[model samples]
Target chain A: GAGVSQSPSNKVTEKGKDVELRCDPISGHTALYWYRQSLGQGLEFLIYFQGNSAPDKSGLPSDRFSAERTGGSVSTLTIQRTQQEDSAVYLCASSFAGGNSPLHFGNGTRLTVT
Target chain B: LAKTTQPISMDSYEGQEVNITCSHNNIATNDYITWYQQFPSQGPRFIIQGYKTKVTNEVASLFIPADRKSSTLSLPRVSLSDTAVYYCLVGDEPISSGSARQLTFGSGTQLTVLP
Candidate 1:
């Protein structure tokens, strides 16, 4: 792909339902990141993948949230028992390492929990 | 973490030069200043970056002070297309504290370029 790609550009789910978002990073990129943006707010760090494994998940807001990357290229973010507060845009980005490299972002998935 | 402060918004006319300044009073010696531009409903795009002094590219110029506590992103002869939210980010490797090159975004300055 030409850039980072995210699935389900938009998602609306009922409270308590589980939802999953997917991201496919730019080919050969070694770093991937996930962030959340609430209404009129700045991007909040969620989780990131150094390759196929996440070195840090401290940004995950709660135990209801989890993520995984496979084959060092694709990632999935899963949220369980969704609550209204879970509504926000989920953005995925990729970079090349200490990579001082600029991040390439996906259009993002706007998840709306009802 | 190195924190940055920037104007909330700015208005400019097409064809004029636009300068957005950011203040990071406690910036680290290894920190690098970076700028990103985002249009409505889209992901932000990297504009330019600098570690010190001045750095120029085909799109913009980054000017950092000797103290490295502040930096400015200069867009020459702006156009309406330049209207967007401009973010100032300061960091080194591991873009954020979480451990990757995660560029943290501040409450960017909204630049409105009028034609």
Candidate 2:
């Protein structure tokens, strides 16, 4: 089976710009999640989607950060008005269901804000 | 949610058994202890999970005592490639659809497997 995949392995953008990171989960996976990892820091949760249920956005740092999983297969994490602090690796993961299966992660997109 | 405490760093020579302990005094009944291994420039990979007692997998083993307040990740005959950061997380079923399964990752224990 193919593993989860993310696009734009690396991205460099100036401050105040917006960027979109995409993720394609493994087939048949209904639960998708987005996470952020800053240098020398732990993984920070961003948002999550599970089938038709309401998406979980509690972990999202701010209003500027938003994510959407369309058709329950692919997801997009968008950062509005990026800042230097936003420099980090954006990771995506998928699972069979919420709380039932372990998560499978993608290699992630490294975002560098200058 | 429970707060995990672990060593900031540890070093071991190749072919040696490495054990890293994590403390979570406030662990709840629904919370399950999970461990993840992460390398530089990569997302974390799941290692093992356990509720109580002990759980062993092909890659590693997890030992949880009767108290369940703490757990240990034991790696057998660690190699240089095993050098990475290990995170211990405790999470439960979300209360609502809007609740993220977002793991509360601690300042992980960095294991340096030296040859």
Candidate 3:
């Protein structure tokens, strides 16, 4: 793809339900990231994947939140037993292998848990 | 990771020049400064990045001092479409870093361009 692509631009789910957000990064990019933004809040880093290394999961708020990147291209963020506080926009970004490369971001998935 | 601080909000008129400054008092040697702009309901878009001195692109210019304690993003002529939240980020090896290493975003500065 030309840029980072996310699926299901908007999602409305009930509390305790599970929701999945998908991201497809640009071809040949080796780094991907996930972030969450609540209403009128700053973006909170969730996870990061670089090439074939283990993903950085320190930013995941709780055990209910998990993510996986397959084939070093597409990634999915899964939120289990969603709560009202989980309502936010989930953003995905990708960049080249080096640290100096700028990140390309997707429009993101807006998840609303009622 | 280097923590950044920016204003909560700023106001500017159309066609005027706007400058937003970010402070990173404890930036490390390997850290690089980057800026991003985001509109309501949209993900952040990369604006510019610089390590020191000045860097200019078609969109904006980034200025970093010798001390590296702070940086500035300058927009030549602002327009209503330029109204957005601008974020400043600092980190080392954004790629190739192991787990627990990544760029962190602050609240960012909200720039409003008025008529």
**Index of the highest-DockQ prediction:** 3
Q: Kindly provide the TM-score obtained by chain B of candidate 3 when compared with the true chain B.
A: 0.94
Please report, as a value between 0 and 1, the fraction of native contacts recovered by candidate 1.
0.53
Residue by residue across A1-114, what tens digits does model 2's lDDT show? 899999999999999999999999999988788888888988888777886344578888888898877787888889999999999999998878755366788989999999
Which of 2 and 3 is ahead in DockQ?
A: 3
What tens-digit string does per-residue lDDT give for candidate 3 at B1-115?
Answer: 6789999999999999999999999998888899999999899999999999999999999999999999999999999999999999988765445643548999999999999
1 or 2, greater by DockQ: 2
Encode model 1's per-residue lDDT on A40-91: one tens digit a residue: 7777878878887787787899999999999999999999999999999999
Quote model 3's iRMS: 1.6
Error of 1 at B49 (Å): 1.0
Lowest-sum lDDT 10-residue window in model 1 chain B:
B95-104
Q: For residue B93, what is the lDDT in candidate 2?
A: 49
Which residue pairs clash within candidate 3?
none
User: What do the candidate models score in CA lDDT, each in turn?
Assistant: 0.88, 0.87, 0.91
Stretches of candidate 2 above 4 Å error?
A52-54, A98-100, B95-98
TM-scores, all candidates, are: 0.95, 0.94, 0.96
Tens-digit lDDT string for candidate 1 (B1-78)? 677899999999999999999999988767788898988777778999999999999999999989999999999999
Ranking by TM-score: 3, 1, 2
Give me the candidate number with maximum TM-score: 3
DockQ, 0 to 1 scale, candidate 3 = 0.72
lDDT of 3 by residue, A1-114 (tens): 388999889999999999999999999998899999998888999998886454578999999998998898999999999999999999999888775788899999999999
